[model samples]
Target: MNLNFDFTEKRVIITAFFCMAFTIANLITVKVINIGFLGMETPAGVLIYPLVYILTNVIADVYGEKIAQRTIILGLCVDILFVFMTTLILFLPSPAYYTGDSSLAFVFTQTPRILVASYISYLIGNFVNARITAKVNEGKEYSSTKNLGILAFSELIDNFVFIGLAFVGVFAVTDILIMIVSHWILSLIWSAIAQPFTKMTVKWAEKGKPAEA
Candidate 1:
């Protein structure tokens, strides 16, 4: 299989950071946080996971779709490794001196069903996001509205797929629906707040060249 290895220090740094962020988000996703708006609760991952999309858009804009897609695939591999290592740690017996074993297992024990849901949703959502971002920007000037729209739509798909698959039997249908809506809305808000930083990063990546769609 042919793969692109084109690299600069900055691109490598950004891709590595993206993978770290992805793994961290996955590890923390089991923790729910209250947003204090309408008493809504969402996975803590929502706060940081949108950065994956934001950075993907930056990559697609600057390096093209192939590189962006490659980055996503690399993130998947890293996430798999993270899961494996964590599971290994969880499966091994803890020494008598270790007091945090129970807490660690509680935090890291994700059902295989949820893991499947996460991987499927991540691949589908991220690829959709990269494709739309790349397609919209082809031979055109950068448009923030369009970028945000792509983010909104992709985030919606991601929230729906993950929540629906992971919680179908564990939660009431209404509750699952609420989770999807709440997570999507919160993710969009977070992405909007991060837009300025994203734009600045894209501009820097462009290095004096105008950004294209």
Candidate 2:
């Protein structure tokens, strides 16, 4: 909120907030929901995951690529650690009065393959988004706001990497096709939503600085 300042504590707090949201979104989106009305499937994380990428892109495009890269690495680490912790929590004892119940246990199965896929998908998708955003903004004096192309490109990278790593050979071609379209369309909407917020953050970051002075 303090646009005129570059306080270390402030940046740290904000960074932590975004990182937590991204990590949590990764956790809860493991369930693939089939829409009852549209007869379509989509990631529960779709509601929040693109926002994470949008944040990283803005960080890379505005502050610097180093920051963006660090954010991705740190975010991945947090997500990985949290998942393991959650698995452990589930392993802990429930009340002795209740016999073992498989009803909910199936959801938190914590298979090795699932863990590996999640890690790979998140890292690859996030890194790709950061790289593209930074590259596109490179050598430009000021932000151009004409970044709709980034939406499509980011979604493509995220979708392909995630689909290949996580869902490859596990689903039909038609299923993959649906995912691609969903990611692309959702990303476009997300990018549009984030554009103004990103511009504001950048301008604030540049505040108190002269034009090339």
Q: How do the predictions measure up, each by TM-score?
A: 0.91, 0.80
Model 2 TM-score, all chains together? 0.80
lDDT of 1 by residue, 128-211 (tens): 999999999976767778899999998899888988999899999999999999999989999988887888777676663423
Model 1: lowest-lDDT 10 consecutive positions: 1-10
Ten-residue region with minimum lDDT total, candidate 2: 204-213
For model 2, how big is the CA root-mean-square deviation?
3.5
Model 1 residue 132 CA deviation in Å:
0.6
State the C-alpha lDDT per candidate: 0.87, 0.68
Candidate 2, 73-121: lDDT as tens digits: 8887787787777677677888878765464466555567656766676
Candidate 2 residue 108 C-alpha distance from true site, Å:
4.3
